[model samples]
Target chain A: MATETTQVNVLTAEDVLKNWQGHRRVTRRTIEAFPEDKLFQFSVGGMRPFSEMAWEFIRMAVPIVDGVTTGKWEEYKGSKPETKSELLRLWDVQTAALDEKFWKIPPHRFSEVDKAFGQWEMPGQATIQYAIDNEIHHRGQGYVYLRALGIAPPHFWERD
Target chain B: MATETTQVNVLTAEDVLKNWQGHRRVTRRTIEAFPEDKLFQFSVGGMRPFSEMAWEFIRMAVPIVDGVTTGKWEEYKGSKPETKSELLRLWDVQTAALDEKFWKIPPHRFSEVDKAFGQWEMPGQATIQYAIDNEIHHRGQGYVYLRALGIAPPHFWERD
Candidate 1:
């Protein structure tokens, strides 16, 4: 009888983080592509302005990482930025925070089930993936908004 | 000396398929949410109507699967379906074809770099991931369209 084997470790923790950051880079470009005024004001088809969507990403992203690492869920209660520069500044800060805290999570924790923010219950990996997927979803909306405004959004495939 | 062991097989082939199909189900609902007249004509901010985006997905998705399985790349050149029912029928058919061809791909091939359609070059897994991500991206636009039309889109989180 022949023995069968499964391929393991197709992706590493580092790979996951880098993949997410790649998407983040593209999202940052999406932010920059917007006219400062339109970033907060322009919306399509009753969708929230891109800035509001961006705030959603900011609120969920680093907080989720923090919750995953420290097992302390703190709801983000920060005020929305009134300017694109302010928003970008906060985005940069959280991006740094995300990198710092993401490393503190042990490899084992990613597979363990936990309730993020004491609400959504899922494995840690799914929680992280949801954050990424949500960003991509909103970014798509941003793209439509940009096109409507006669601006071309960043290329979706240029994640890096 | 202590040895460090890496976790392997965190996700299996089946998990990947189920994840993609879950997104597909939500996208299918997005199709159903549209009024028949608006399904092909509605637009937001100069973006393509939902039907056109759906055609883009149909063009890229299963053909990529076929290319992955057979190592033959043929561009999808079928004409767009004019009616929403015709469109949904094609969507369902492709969904079945996707499942059928997805499994024919060997696990090892997923990690190999190949140019899908002789253009984009990446690992087979990334290619497939792009297809799913692209769907989510366009579906986000569909959500905005639905809301603009005073129709509620499907719950994005209800991917199961």
Candidate 2:
């Protein structure tokens, strides 16, 4: 059978930038919904704690993005804060930087490959994409934890 | 500051069944790796083409489940087809039945809802969570479509 590959239209750097920005907005809102007490909760003994997952969310982004652009696991020199509020503040700052800087990415750069987590070889675009998608994935777990604790997270229906 | 009021989770019974079934390994294998022509090519626009939105694997399951449980829709009531030659034929049949059955779901029964879809009046779960997460959700879309097209998807790196 002749296969039809659905090519995602080549989006402008600006469009991709907007998409990342939109993801950030939703992420921040999700952060705002969390109560402090449950920050470290993990649904199972084996899974990453929510607090740890939140930190993982932070650690994963810069190195992943750096890997894509630089093609190596660059030393991530950013300071890790001690509290969730500080983490959230740093998150907002870094994501804002992404929104502002992501548009400057050249279109020809999509094929650039980089090492993620200092181990895996992945595309630069994949790193950034993982940054966005990973949050949605884990934030999902956050919802499960929230429900278990009787704290409702934001509704998925309404958009900011 | 206007605190964002928590939102409700509104999903039809149809949404629930499709989501659960869509995540099945057999279903994932069938939908994600179908021929691109068959997988990406579909009859709708604005809506994801079947091949592209492998994430929508849940579409067929939701409506069929809803119809069977609620007795409200007629979309899934046709005589079952007997033979299957191509990769997507079974996938198509199941999805179509579910879609038809979705229309049959009664409005009043939405309160009872599916475990996966949750309820329509609470801020407890996200529609996208129920819509995407409970089903194939994140890793399912292009990944499975690629598989359906005979390209192997990336292995779960964390999995041993």
Candidate 3:
């Protein structure tokens, strides 16, 4: 187990925000790199239509972070928007929030217990990390689809 | 730019440790989640080979924290192993070092710029988060390959 100390540190928060935004930019580029025809149609088992995955990305972040700060799922914003541009706009807002709110997190909150997905109970920070990991997991699949569709995505290592 | 605090917060260290371990577990699971044949064979064009990407996950972490504590890339020890298990053994060692060495970093040192990656310079913490994010980005691809190979991966929201 890790130890807890007296003061707060926001460096990880800042770095997380930077990495998160970089992810958003590259992922958005992945989406735009695909053809409209394949974006909605390509899937391995007809699982997670690319269009739905894109929309889900918008809904995923706010609710997870809201749960972190507020400790209630109902505090999450309303439903995701239907259009792609609207989804992108919503994503931009939350990504910016991650940066702005980085320093606002209270110390020792990493160990704060929280409920997730209506059942899973774990640390608040774990929940947040899981959410981020989940999105990246799906986006990776989207990368595969893009490649199969003959589109070249941004390089794996390039952050900007 | 983020402000520097001389205060040492234990929770931030805990979170960093958690993130470090989580990254290790998830990357391992991502590889385990793939069938052996698919693990090394799959990738989008111009994407790093899957095995190479896995090594990159281990390669990226050491120097960040090394730079933070030692302030020099000369202290970085990223010896590439010839086989997979050897690579994992090295990964386990470095991750433990991250848990041990990085926690010793005073809060004031977080803002210290570390030319950790040789070409890229960032706050010591950004180096750590970049490693995490980069691993997640590639692991996301691992999940896609899992699905395509007729293997069902655990839900990302669920921790095992």
Candidate 4:
């Protein structure tokens, strides 16, 4: 039998945005739970500190939203925040920008393949999934760091 | 103007399975890189060891595929493997099972909502995303575990 192909409605654009935002909420709380000294300085098995990973997120997410309007990626030129609080402030600013622009993406665009950030060439929805997946993956490291530092990390299911 | 409601075909069911399987490949490699004693015994900030988290993955994934066909979630009753090799064997077996059964899910079923394992009520596609998302989240902790052990982690994007 020839392999079958059927178009499937996996998720709505709204559902996608909500899930992404929900996870962002959880990751922000995970950062707040970290001790400042350790958050900036600690490394496990040679991975960078959570503070470093946090920057990757801000850099990546801002592009996802900005690319929606520009379709051209701009390298993050802002200086890296030296402290965790400053990191959170930058994150909040990007979050607000995402909230404003994400809804404007017309539904048909999600299925169209586009080059993201000048390198990634994938469907729009896949790019969005990448943002969420990348965050969840990094925050998991933060949890391990917190546990190592004797702090209880936020529960995985608590995305509020 | 009333906002449009279109059931966009963002990802085909096959694409979903391929992505989930790809991540599993990366996660399995992550497990192999961990030292045996630390895999089971090490916990930072009081989180359970990577071994315990591995069990959660097995428990969750098998049910997701099995429940897809049987509509009944079977609690994983297999004895927990104490050694990493045995754990890999169990994972491979489950991977085989998932590979076979995952395709049996009709494409349209993905849009239907059901109580997965009689607990989670969500669209079938979202349930699959849950399985993938959960694995990515936990494997991140495994990365931290390896880093803390002074071992190099398998790169995040390597999935074969």
Candidate whose lDDT is highest? 1
Model 2 reproduces a share of the real contacts of 0.01
* Pairwise DockQ winner, candidates 3 and 4: 4
DockQ result, candidate 4: 0.54
Candidate 2 wrong stretches, greater than 4 Å: A1-5, A8-12, A157-159, B1-57, B60-160
Tens-digit lDDT string for candidate 4 (A1-160): 1145234445666667777888888888987888888889986767789998888888888677666545666877789998889988988988887777776666666766888877888877778778888899999888777877778878777666
Stretches of candidate 3 off by over 4 Å are A1-19, A44-47, A75-83, A89-111, A155-160, B1-11, B33-37, B44-46, B74-83, B104-107, B158-160
For model 4, how does the per-residue alpha-carbon lDDT over B67-127 read when each residue is reduced to its tens digit? 7655676787789999999999998998888777776766556767888988888777777
Error in Å for residue A35 of model 4: 3.1
Candidate 1 ranges beyond 4 A from true positions? A1-10, B1-9, B77-79
Lowest summed lDDT across 10 adjacent residues in model 1 chain B is found at B1-10
Candidate 1 residue pairs that clash? A9-B8
State residue B9's C-alpha deviation in candidate 4, in Å: 3.3
Question: Can you list the residue pairs that collide in candidate 3?
Answer: A5-B10
Q: Of the pair 3 and 4, which is ahead by lDDT?
A: 4
> For model 2, how big is the iRMS in angstroms?
17.8
What number of clashing residue pairs does each candidate have, in the order they appear? Answer: 1, 19, 1, 8
Docking class of 4: medium
Would you estimate the TM-scores of all the predictions? Answer: 0.90, 0.52, 0.76, 0.88
lDDT of 1 by residue, B61-125 (tens): 98888776667889887778999999999999999987777777766667778988889998777
DockQ of each: 0.37, 0.05, 0.30, 0.54
* Real contacts retained, model 4: 0.62
Higher-scoring candidate on TM-score, 1 or 2: 1
